[model samples]
Target chain A: MRTIELSDRQEKIIEIVKESGPITGEKIADRLNLTRATLRPDLAILTMAGFLDARPRVGYFYTGKSSTQLLSESVNKIKVNEYKSIPVVVNENVSIYDAIVTMFLEDVGTLFVVDDKSLLVGVLSRKDCLRASIGKQELNSVPVHIIMTRMPNITTCKSDDLLIDVAEKLIEKQIDSIPIVKEKEEGLEVIGRVTKSNITKAFVTLFKKD
Target chain B: MRTIELSDRQEKIIEIVKESGPITGEKIADRLNLTRATLRPDLAILTMAGFLDARPRVGYFYTGKSSTQLLSESVNKIKVNEYKSIPVVVNENVSIYDAIVTMFLEDVGTLFVVDDKSLLVGVLSRKDCLRASIGKQELNSVPVHIIMTRMPNITTCKSDDLLIDVAEKLIEKQIDSIPIVKEKEEGLEVIGRVTKSNITKAFVTLFKKD
Candidate 1:
């Protein structure tokens, strides 16, 4: 796919089409005082770009679609599975110290807390850990579940969920990451992770991708 | 600007132009066993979309620019000043506990540490704070400068720098945020910040922006 900048005349053609109803190409050319040959390329471009639609009996009419809408549609097509990273998990009973160590070892900003069945129970962010660190409680003795944002409060996504929606959730919740979970009879099983870093990487790939 | 998928003949035309030298529209048409009138719109579309360039007397030749290249060009045009957030800073001598409190109050992932002269001295990420928290030292007594990622190793950008470059630095350095700085006689001054969150927001705006 390629992007194009509309010419001044083409923009004028769109304005004309927007105001007029299914106007013929010949009539459009006449309105602009240009020949059919001069207007043909602009009309073709407008139609092909989806700004205007042409029918057999009718001439041209605005498609009511803007470039931004098309761009959004393409962006919204990206799924979580395409960009998610391997989720790092720690047992809910693990010490805050151990979870912090695991985070540093994995080089990830967030860690998911799981139960005995490896089902997600909570999320541990750097902020949560840092907050706990400053508290009077001993880091080694206190379990992560006490500090973690537990499930029901945690924002989660599925593999098929749109990445854009996850990005929005990240912004809205002011959180670092979300666990990509799979539904099970027992609970939601953590399968993947999406962070601002992952979103940033996806953003870079957007333009870099061939 | 609008993106459009190229037709099969358009792709073939590009392939032909890539092989041929400064080919004319008539020659391109003849090679494809089509008349110039039939090929006019395709030629116009290719040229307008930047896949091919046309000359008055020389005809048409491939511009050698792919859709990805154009897409990257447009992406690179976005500058750091357009998306950078306010730089949250703390004095270098401040305790790690105080810095963490400031981070919480400001709701920022990273904090810039400055000297009395307001010159950047170090950077403290949430990871840095978390690391310090798990250490043996007292959070209140230990100054941020001792634990913070100090200058000379800091990743920074100017307001005028391309955001893509900053985004790349974030990925390559495996860092959360970079301070947007200005050079001074004394030292670098932090003016703004660019984080993965900012890049994610920019990604969303890329599609949502009109």
Candidate 2:
């Protein structure tokens, strides 16, 4: 495929389409402070480049598939460190209920369950809590270690993994998030987490707005 | 917090806010096939119940923080199976480069590196790919095993964890995704993946308009 060079105007047009797809050309032009005449050529280039599609009356909307493709390509070019987020953790001894409570209060989904040494041991999620509750398992009495998913079975991403790669995992696995980990002298240590929301937010920032 | 009983109108208003939060009252009313005047009381009830929030000019946006609280309380009522997602995986012999590519192409952030036995051994991520690429490490030659963050050190969730707990781990870890794993006779295998996007999407669906 021939490379389609996008001018500043063209890039802005793509962003507008992403945010408010199925929008009209006039609306796009108006949002970006450009006249229809000025945006026509850019629109043509974008459409030709497979970045966007235009309908007769619905205006221009980004092809959903194209955004994923664009994101993969762009993310491949970015270093992983640029996108790493902070890490959240739980200890093995923590009660499943406590861990569950912690997860809710923290606004995160995965908890890194660690040993007394702070060595990563297992991971816990809302599902585990649900099971314990349903099983009528004792919350405070039962340790997370009883139901936590152990390591060697955990999926991990490093700090330098690409955002596109992350996005792909979320889609392919139909999973929502992955943890960013690092190799320490002793073992792998929890470093960060990357979720589909982060990828979406990143996509919104990188390609959705001018 | 006191329980707030929602009328059909109020429930619809919450549904609108959840679907396209950070929207305005006017937009919500329009989408619900109602007038702003008709929606006002419902909106008030929802806001008071902590199910919805109103911004000055930004319209209505789902309060991400509040959802976590609501979720935490409601979590006690949800079954574990409701929050699980399918897992995506890669084999141990796979190259880091290939893994990275897989991640990008699949739109996922994490890859579970498994053994021929289908047992998870290590996890790879977009960040890992970035570090390897940036460090100019061998791409075609570097095996995922060499660079993978080994297991027993990774974080994970089970299919039965609570949603509130999952949310907390996600936020505290500052990571985006988590893997769901189940045990088998041979070893542990990944059963699903979860990310913030999934949680948010689930949350959005909770109040979606019919």
Candidate 3:
């Protein structure tokens, strides 16, 4: 797809069509005091760009679709599965100290906490761990489950979920990362992870790809 | 600007132009076994969209710009100043406990450390604080400068710098945020902060904008 900046006359034509749509090309040209031949290219462009729809007998109708709208449509097609990273998970019974070690060893901002069945139970952000580290309790004695953002409170997404929607969730919720999960008979199983880093990478990829 | 998918014929025309550009409309039409009148609209659309350029008598030259190239061009125009957040700062002499408290109070993932002159001297992430908290040193006794990532090690950006370039830096350095700084007589003054969150916001805004 190619993006084109509309000329003054083309904008005028859209304005006219929006006001008196289903009007013939000849009539649109007449309203602008231009010949039919002069407006052909502009009309063609508008029609092809999906801004205006043309009919043989009824004339041109304003599609009410703006250029930037297509940009969003393209972004909406991106799925979380395409950009998600392998989830770094720890059993909920693990010590906070061990969890912090896992986070540093994995070099990820967040970690998923799971049950004995390997079902997701909670999430650990660097913020959460840091908060726990400064607490009065000993880090080695405290289980991560005691401090993690627990289930029902944790924001989760599926692998097939739209990446843009997850990005929106990240902003709205003001969190660092989310666990991508899958449904099982017993509970939700952590399958992947999506973070602001993933979103940032996707953002960079948008401009880099041809 | 509006994005449009090119018709097969239009794509074919571009191929012809790419291979034997500066070829006249009549020549391109002849190669496709179509009349010049049939090709006028395609040529016009291509020229107006900046894919092909037409001269008075020299025919058309392929601009060598792909559709996605324009996407990057528009993205490159976004400046860091437009999306930066207020920089949360701490003093170098402040205790690590105080710095962690400042981080929690400010609710920012990163903090900029300043000297007695209130200029940037070091940077801190939650990871930094967590690491310090786990160490043998007492949080209230050790100064932040001892644990903070010091000068020449911190990544920084200017307000006027392109946001995309900063995004690349964030990915390359694997750091959460960068301090937006301005040069002073003695040191760099922290003006703002740009993080993966800011870049993520910018990505979402691209689609949401009209």
Listed in order, the DockQ scores are 0.44, 0.02, 0.45
Question: TM-score for every candidate vs. truth?
Answer: 0.81, 0.37, 0.82
TM-score of chain B of 2: 0.63
For lDDT, candidate 2 versus 3, the one ahead is 3
Tell me how candidate 3 scores on lDDT: 0.88
For residues A77-130, could you state the per-residue lDDT of candidate 2 as single tens digits?
554456656767888997876777686678666678888777788777654554
Docking class of 3: acceptable
Candidate 3, residue A157: how far the Cα is off, in Å: 1.0
Can you give the lDDT of residue B57 in candidate 1? 98
Per-residue CA lDDT of model 3 for B32-79, tens digit only, reads 999999998888888887789999899998998765665566677789
Segments in model 3 whose C-alpha atoms lie over 4 Å from true places: A5-66, A208-210, B5-44, B47-65, B208-210
Candidate 1 vs candidate 3, DockQ winner: 3
Superposed by TM-score, candidate 2 places the C-alpha of residue B205 at a distance from the truth, in angstroms, of 22
Model 1, span B1-210: residue lDDT tens: 556667899989999999995999999999999999999988887887678898899879888776555556667778989999999999999999999999999999899999999999999999888888888878889999999899799999999998888898899899999999999998999999999989988887776433
At residue A165, give the lDDT of candidate 1: 84
Which candidate number would show the highest DockQ if scored against the true structure?
Answer: 3
Tell me the whole-model lDDT of each prediction, alpha carbons only.
0.87, 0.65, 0.88
- Cα lDDT of model 1 by residue, A53-109, tens digit: 998779899888765555565677789899999999999999999999999999888
TM-score attained by model 3: 0.82
| Preferred candidate (TM-score higher): 1 or 3 | 3
